[model samples]
Target: MPMRLTKLLGIELPITQAPMAGVQGHALTVAVSNAGGLGSLPCAMLSADALRNELTAISRQ
Candidate 1:
């Protein structure tokens, strides 16, 4: 069966990695996304430049 959340998010799986503010990063988010899940990038603690870089990294993954 197709996963509902996956369809909702346009991801390959229903899993969603938590946007753990201090612990999650670009590499981890990419890994989760690559594994067919929604990888969340938390921006609450990041500087503008850091968020931009992380977004770029995620896009490249």
Candidate 2:
């Protein structure tokens, strides 16, 4: 059967990285994305400017 999760998430693999607040940042998210898995960014603890910066960094990768 086709991998439904991969199809739904638009990722090459079915793997998904859980958002790790304080332990992970945009770099890790980008790395997982580049590796063809679904990566998560934890924004619950971030300020608006910090979130914007993280997004910008992720977009640059």
TM-score for every candidate vs. truth?
A: 0.82, 0.93
Put down candidate 1 lDDT per residue, 1-61, tens digits, no spaces: 4676778888998788999998879888888888898888899999999999999988886
Best by TM-score: 2
Angstrom error of the Cα, residue 28, model 2: value is: 0.5
- Pairs with steric clashes in candidate 1: none
Distance from true position, residue 21, model 1, in Å? 1.0
lDDT of candidate model 1 versus the reference: 0.86
Candidate 1 displacement at residue 50 in angstroms: 1.1
